[model samples]
Target: MHWLVLIISGVFEAVWATALGKSEGFSRLGPSIIFAVTVIISMGGLAFAMRELPTGTAYAVWVGIGASGAVAYSMMTGAEAASIAKIVCIIAIVAGVVGLKLAS
Candidate 1:
């Protein structure tokens, strides 16, 4: 359950990141609100998961998920240009996340 919450929180991290970019320094009402809410959820989940998980491992996994997810979302939406290198990097991040999970 903690792992599940952590993963969900990581996804929310990506959502909040994207919303933050769209928020334009909080000038946009909708995206700003989305960012605000999602960030809190993400942080709360992270804090909760930290109770049972190693801090380093949890943080790395969370960041790995968020970074890869944000980039993938951007690429899929055509907000960011896609390249073989980018795809490979995302794959690597995923692999690392999986590796961390396995190690744990």
Candidate 2:
């Protein structure tokens, strides 16, 4: 359950990140609200998950998920360029996250 929450929180981190970019320094109302809401949820879940998981493993996995999710979303939306190198790097991040889970 903690791991599940942690993973979901990681995805919310990506959502908040993307919404922040769209918020345009909080000038936009909709995305700004989205950012605010998701950020809270993300942080709360992380804090909760940290109670059971090792800090290092939890943090690394959270960051890995968020970073890869944001990059993947941007690539899909054409907001960022897609390249073989970038894809490989995202895959590496995912692999690391999985490795951490298995190690734990």
Candidate 3:
């Protein structure tokens, strides 16, 4: 159950990160609200999951999931370039996150 929550929080991390970019430094209201709300929710979920998981494992997994997911979304939307190197790194991030999960 805690793992599930952690994963979901990781997804929210991507959401808040993407929204933060879209927020344009808070000049945009909609995405700014999204960023604010999701930031709280994501952090809250992370805090909750931390109660049941190791600090290092939980933090690393959270960051990995968020970073890779946001980068993938940008690549897919053409907001960021989709180069071979970038793809490889994204895969690496995902692999690391999964490895952490499995190790846990």
Candidate 4:
């Protein structure tokens, strides 16, 4: 179940990152609160997962998920421009995340 926790943590990482972007330099109250809360939870979950998962593996997966998810979310929400190159980069991040997990 460690891997499950790690995945959940990664999801939370995505959430917090998106929230941070919406927070608008922390001027927006609601998103700011959400950003803070999710950041804490995401890190907490990562700490728990690290008890079993290797540090390199867990950190790479966490960062990869956050990066890819943020870009995808931005694209879907029309918050950022989308392009073939962006999509390819997202895929590459996914592959790297998978490769790290598999290597561990």
Candidate 5:
């Protein structure tokens, strides 16, 4: 399904984003490879999903997933602060993603 592909792409987007940060200007080898691969796969999946899903809706969803997942991963990995405000913002992003999907 297109939706499934979109969500999977979003997940890959998150992975690539986090990996990019860890890559440290591409100084790191492993994470850099992961970043490149996931980024390509994520974009490819997004393009495929766009064939059926509206561009705006799919983009918003993909961004929402990447943002939320990256923040969560950073917090869990102790790479970023985990504050109440951050959590609230992530929740808001989720709400917006859901609203867009429902309204579409």
Candidate 6:
């Protein structure tokens, strides 16, 4: 259950990150609101998960999910350049996150 929460928190990290980018420095009301709300939820989930998971591993997983999701979204939306290297690196991050989970 803690792992589930942690994974969800990581997903929200991506949600907030994407919303923040769309917020245009908090100028846009909708995206800004989305960013604020998701950030809180994401952090809350992270904190909850931290009660059971090791801090270092949890943080790494959280960051890995967020970064991987954000990059994938950017590429899919044409907001960022896509390349094989970028995809491979994102996969590596995900693999590392999974490896950590398995090792733990």
**Would you list the C-alpha lDDT of every candidate in the order shown?**
0.97, 0.97, 0.94, 0.91, 0.95, 0.97
Backbone clash pairs for candidate 3 read: none
**Model 6 Cα RMSD, 1 decimal:** 0.5
| Deviating ranges (above 4 Å) for candidate 3 | none
Candidate 2: residue 48 lDDT (0-100): 96
Write model 4 residue lDDT over 1-104, tens digit each, in one string. Answer: 88888888888899999999889999999999999999999999899999999998898898888888888999999999999999999999999988987887
Per-residue lDDT for 1-104 in model 2, tens only?
Answer: 99999999999999999999999999999999999999999999999999999999999999899999999999999999999999999999999999999999
Give the clashing residue pairs of candidate 1, or none.
Answer: none
Candidate 6 TM-score, C-alpha based: 0.98
Q: Per-residue lDDT tens digits of candidate 6, residues 1-104?
A: 99999999999999999999999999999999999999999999999999999999999999999999999999999999999999999999999999999999
Candidate 6 clash figure, as a count: 0
- For model 6, what is the error of residue 104's alpha carbon versus the real structure, in angstroms, after optimal superposition? 0.5
Q: Provide the lowest-lDDT 10-residue window in model 2.
A: 55-64
lDDT of 3 at 32: 97
lDDT of 2 at 54: 98
Superior by TM-score: candidate 2 or candidate 5: 2
- What TM-score, computed on C-alpha atoms, does each candidate reach? 0.99, 0.99, 0.96, 0.94, 0.97, 0.98
Evaluated at residue 49, the lDDT of candidate 6 is 92
Q: Judged by lDDT against the true structure, how good is candidate 2?
A: 0.97
The runs of at least 3 residues in candidate 6 whose Cα sits more than 4 Å from the true structure, single-residue gaps closed, are: none
Instruction: Tell me the lDDT of model 5 at 4.
Output: 90
Candidate 1 lDDT tens digits, 1-104 = 88999999999999999999999999999999999999999999999999999999999999999999999999999999999999999999999999999999
